[model samples]
Target chain A: MTALAEPIGRGGAERASLARRASGWLVLALVLVSLASLFVGATGLSPFAFLKAMLAGDAVDLRTKVVILDIRLPRLALGLLVGASLAVSGVVMQGLFRNPLADPGLVGVSAGAGLGAIVAIVLGGLLPPALAAAMGYALVPIAAFAGSWLSVIVLYALATRGGQTSVATMLLAGIALAALVGAVSGTLIYMADDAQLRTLTFWSMGSLGGATWGKVAAAAPLMLAGLIAAPFLARGLNALALGEPAARHMGVDVQVLKRVAVVTVAAAVGSAVAVSGGIGFLGIVVPHLLRLSIGPDHRYLLINSALLGAIILTLADMVARVVVAPAELPIGIVMAVIGGPFFLWILMRRRGLMMGL
Target chain B: MLTAETLTVRLGAHEILQAVDFTAHAGEVTAIVGPNGSGKTTLLRALTGDVAFTGAARIGALDVARAKPWELASRRGVLAQFTGVAFPFTVAEIVRLGQASGTAGAATDLTEQALARVGLAGFAPRRYHDLSGGEQQRVQLARVLAQVWEPLDESGPRWLVLDEPVASLDIAHQIEVMELARAFARAGGGVVAVMHDLNLTAMFADAVALMARGRVVTQGPVTAVFRDSTLSDAYGCKLRVNVAPPSSTFILPHAALT
Candidate 1:
């Protein structure tokens, strides 16, 4: 009889009504920010001017028109893709690892990707100009994805004991792998000439300067594929959040689900890293925020986190573009400047959640 | 029909359950009882093919060892003690997951009915993470119920496997769930539970199976197995046994050793 007070009144229409209202406000806020991105840049474009430019498909100045379409629009689109990928990846990592403090980058995945890109740059600089010119920017991102996937595979192999993945051992192994990759990165920096060092520094900090339509075009399809595949994974993920054995009992192929999530996260984060560089913590922050907003159902959580992540990244990138007008700061730096404080707040606010980390 | 033949399960160096053999008939509640680490949960998992076992389980001409995931899913609905809910799924949405064929037909309605059976009606639209532990279990129970809830002709052999189902429930809900399991068995479904409470097991179980060190020590009708000597042996200590006037059984662990 005790602890059964009022049956918790399953499906109170009134509570559902409130949740819907909150979601409405969140969506509305995102819309306003997206629209704001069109106008609130260094260019003296008004909301009406930006909207007209978007709809009318023309501008008085050809350069301005090109900037809106070629520069800002693709930048906005890439932001959305990267954001969605990181948020979804973060949520998946949390479930897959069964630790609230867990993030996709926990297993040295992003670090590996970053190191891969840095190495590509080092090797490319050594190559003859004709060969380098043929490859263009493609080699770096491709190398990054390959390295990231390899790191994930190694971590998975290391962390798995018998058939089960131990959450603690995985985390520890991730940390160790990250340190090793990080040391490699540091050595590269030490050996590089000023130009390579500069490139390495910017890439390591993360950036959206490389946000061309080409990169966005590449990222969009993979992001869409991940977003589509993510919601179907909710049932298995929700079951996993309890523990592996419990998930297995509920007819969830626990190991299969883990593999699916790991691969999905790898692909999603790998592509995001390929384009935007090593943007830390957006993956960690957005999923937690979504959990706070909606209850912990992956069906809603996955989609909402994607949207929120896109909206936040766009808004942050907008700030990055304007903060030092003419010489735009990299968006990754902007995110860190904002994200670091918020992360501290979260750990302080949710100590219990951080325990498993 | 469920039969466990000399099942021995080991975890690390600990022999949690050893050579356990028992059979549970359809349309009856079979309760497995013992102290902590006596391997009750392991036996249930072994039966469902969730864990590997040294022996085999035969259910209606099917072997547990070679059964496919879907094959096992169709024959048994299991509720592990700790069900994780890290995502934000509505209660109804969660219950609907038990739909193997992925349709919202009569079976879906039965899921809602099952939730109602566990006093979780109208909670369907609520977020799962916001609910208490007991509420989550009911939602899980509803999910299992929906998985097993089939139409008349397609109603194949199904067994309910619950590991500590009532551990997190309130006293009232505990009785409600016990009564539901009893009713399901009465309606031709099989029920196997790993439970700790001797009193509730006495009230609802048709037969009692005892496990120790990963093996079924003995199993029989409730009246025969739930004796002072059996209780003492089950816990590896001397234990007092009392039969209440209301036909309920009681047990206690005797004092410490040197």
Candidate 2:
């Protein structure tokens, strides 16, 4: 009773409020970017014209309607889902690893997922005919999830000791895993037929170009499961920042939390990579920016990262479509160009405070 | 009551703690004191379930090994020797993590209240990483304090299990921390602290458990355990305990050894 005084002017409350406020701004950005994406494709449908035609009850042309509804809508949906998944996965990974640099891409989860997708694509025929038929379109995403899940388990085992994660060990192991995965993927690529080769080439340069309702349906639930599951792990992840033993002391079920977090990351990253290929940097970039703006509380960080991630990736997708006109650049290229330099800047700024990496 | 009977901790092939029997009653401050590498920390960790140990440790009737983490956490708050925040969390935010709802639901303003108790009033906005070592340690203490703000809850008396709580504090702050622990004990809670400073231990502890080489060398009331022979033999040095000052005991390493 002696220490219990009047609690006043709490900063945590203010930070939480700021994070909540930012979500509104990010939602607005997402809407604006989504609208722009709908109208700014290579086919060039003017938004004003489309709205006017629809308002006037004029029968929109089949081609125009198809472009707007079928192509742009699914692409936008897939973009939002993949973007949110990547960003949320990044938050979870950083929280689990207790380091901001611990991104899915940086830690080779993306590469592992990529390997899974390549394996599924190149070896689909080798599967028992009945099993392959039953798996259908879900095969690639499932394979990718398994691959990412496996990689996370292996990485966690290697880099973590007595509940402390070694950033240096994680990064080096990531590079090593990526190299091994690349070699495996290369062997698979070499064996691919010409048709599979085209699919492989296009998929490697991450793009939302092949977005179909079927593809969206296939990947959405997996990513949605991950996105939904992440917020539940937010408090646990927050406690984990204080180290495993302390987190456990704080009533966090550290083992269960870690298991959920690993699965959530795999589910999100694996499916996102399956559909969008290796879309680099959205995971690290979005979460880092949100942390800088809103502070590192996962309660806010997870949701805000989802919103901002969707906004950024959608915006990136628009730029990818607009910059080259009919022949679009891969969104992956755009992200790497932006995120690579940004990552280097972060590394330089934080060189002094790697927290004993 | 918190009790650990025949507690043994083995890390790989090394036995960090061997057959350590310990007990601390509610409304008392029990200090575990010993020289370096005396297994003081390991014993505390075993009691707190931070380490895997072969022992029967109990908080009241709840067994340490079988009890869920939340079950134990609700009864006691632990302050580890070192806590590193991975991200740039504010002081208030870190402390808020100790609120009951830190695991879920909405949390009250206990964050600021705890900070004030640790002599860190109005430090809620400062980044945790920017604080000095002593300040950071106090911040962690504030967090642990917030976790079990009420010494005696409806269930029973809560506990403060601290490992070198004042290791990084200044002399004045050291007294402040000891006084805080004493206040908690006075308010019907038990406090178990792993201490290195024998003088502070003598001044504040109600009971003492002097340990050496993973075993309890002596355990009893402060007067009985703070004898010159017992202190000197356990610490492996000539330690002189002055009983001249009756209000608070003092232990000094003998200046001239025989």
DockQ of 2: 0.57
| TM-score of predicted structure 1 | 0.83
Candidate 1: segments with Cα more than 4 A from true spot: A1-61, A128-130, A161-167, A337-357, B12-16, B58-63, B68-71, B84-116, B119-153, B167-175, B227-258
Best by DockQ: 2
- The runs of at least 3 residues in candidate 2 whose Cα sits more than 4 Å from the true structure, single-residue gaps closed, are A1-10, A106-108, A120-146, A149-176, A189-199, A340-357, B101-107, B256-258
lDDT of 1 by residue, A73-146 (tens): 78778887888888888988887776566888887678789889988877667878898888798878878988
Top-lDDT structure, candidate number: 2
lDDT of 1 by residue, B64-84 (tens): 888655566666777878776
Predicted complex 1: CAPRI docking category: acceptable
TM-score of candidate 2 chain B vs. the reference? 0.95
Q: What is the alpha-carbon interface RMSD for each candidate?
A: 5.1, 3.5
Candidate with the greatest TM-score versus the true structure:
2
